[model samples]
Structure formats: structure tokens, C-alpha cells
Target: MVLMLGFVTIVAAALAAGYLLGRLRPWRRAGDWAADQVRFTGAWVRGGVVRQAVVVLVHVVTAPRTSWRIMRTPAADTTAPVPVRDPDWVAHRTRADKGGTP
Candidate 1:
């Protein structure tokens, strides 16, 4: 069909334009500049990721030692009663073991 031929012509023209632009001197310089910008952005992101990974690795490596130190401290009390946030809920339940009802 004529429409299909027109579409093919348009695609071929676009390809030829792209090829010429890619091969020409000024466009090649522009392409290199664009590539450098992408390279710099990628490097920046990579550096940030590496820096955060190092920070996480440090925390992971020191966590056990930090926990052990806190556990061994004099202020760490094991015999303290843990306070419940919902102590009143026990009164509403049935105590089958003690033969008590709600």
C-alpha cells in the first residue's frame, strides 16, 4: 500500500539522518559530551552507593560487640519486671484452668 511505502520511507530517512549525525564532526562531539555526562552521573551514584554500603557494613560488623558491651554494663538489669501496656485485658478473659468466668 502507499501508506506502508510512506512509512518505510520515513523510517529510512530517520535512519539515514541518525547515521549522518552520528558520523559528523559536531554531532560526534555532542554525543561524546552526552556520554561523559552520563558517565559522571553514573559515577556519582556508584560512589554514593559504595559509601552507604561501607557504612552499613561497619554497623553490621560492630553490632554484636556493641550489644555485648551493653549487656555487660552495670546498668543492664535482667531481674526487672517488664511492664505490660495492656494489663486490664486479663480481667475480661475466662480462666478455664482456675474455673473462672469472664
Candidate 2:
């Protein structure tokens, strides 16, 4: 009887938590969560909150430059290739050459 009661209580608690989360779903989309997560420590963070903030700050500033330094830039092509032949102009001729077809 006690085991059955304990199982019932755990299932009831799970359902209650699920119901509460479902009711609060609309409030979750109020802002960009990625930006917020980057700017500040999560409420779940306990003693190491300040250290997390410093590490995230260092990443934000230095990582972009380090990535840029590794990137390769395209070298300019200084000269254009010389054209060898005249373009075909068969359609644009004002008169047909010897035949009725242009």
C-alpha cells in the first residue's frame, strides 16, 4: 500500500509540473534567449557566476579577431585576358545574306 501511494504521488507531481510549464509557455518567447544567455549568468548558476561572466567576456572580444587572422583573403587579378575573336552577330543583321532566312 505504501509503495502504491508513493508511485501515485510521483505521477501526480509530474503531471502538476507539466501543467504549470504548459501554462507558462507564452512568456518564454518574449525576447532573444541566445542574447540574454550570453549577456548574463543563468539563475541556475551558483558560486561560479562571476568566473563564467569573465570567461564569456574574453571569448566575445578575442575569438572574432583570432578567427579573422586565420581567414584567407582573395588576391586581386591585376590584368584581364585579351579577347581573340569578334562576337557572332547573325541575328542582328539588317538584311538576309543571299537567302530569305536571317
Which regions of candidate 2 are displaced past 4 Å?
30-102
State the weakest 10-residue window (summed lDDT) of model 1: 30-39
Query: Model-by-model lDDT, in order?
Result: 0.59, 0.57
- TM-score for candidate 1: 0.27
What is the C-alpha lDDT profile of model 1 across 6-93, one tens digit per residue? 9999999999988887678664454454444333545434667775454334433445465356447786466668787766766755
The CA lDDT at 44 in model 1 is: 33
Q: Which segments of model 1 are wrong by more than 4 Å? A: 28-102
lDDT of 2 by residue, 1-102 (tens): 999999999999999999997887633432234235443656525537785565445444545553344344564578668877636656545556645666
The lDDT, on a scale of 0 to 1, for candidate 2 is: 0.57
Best candidate, lDDT: 1
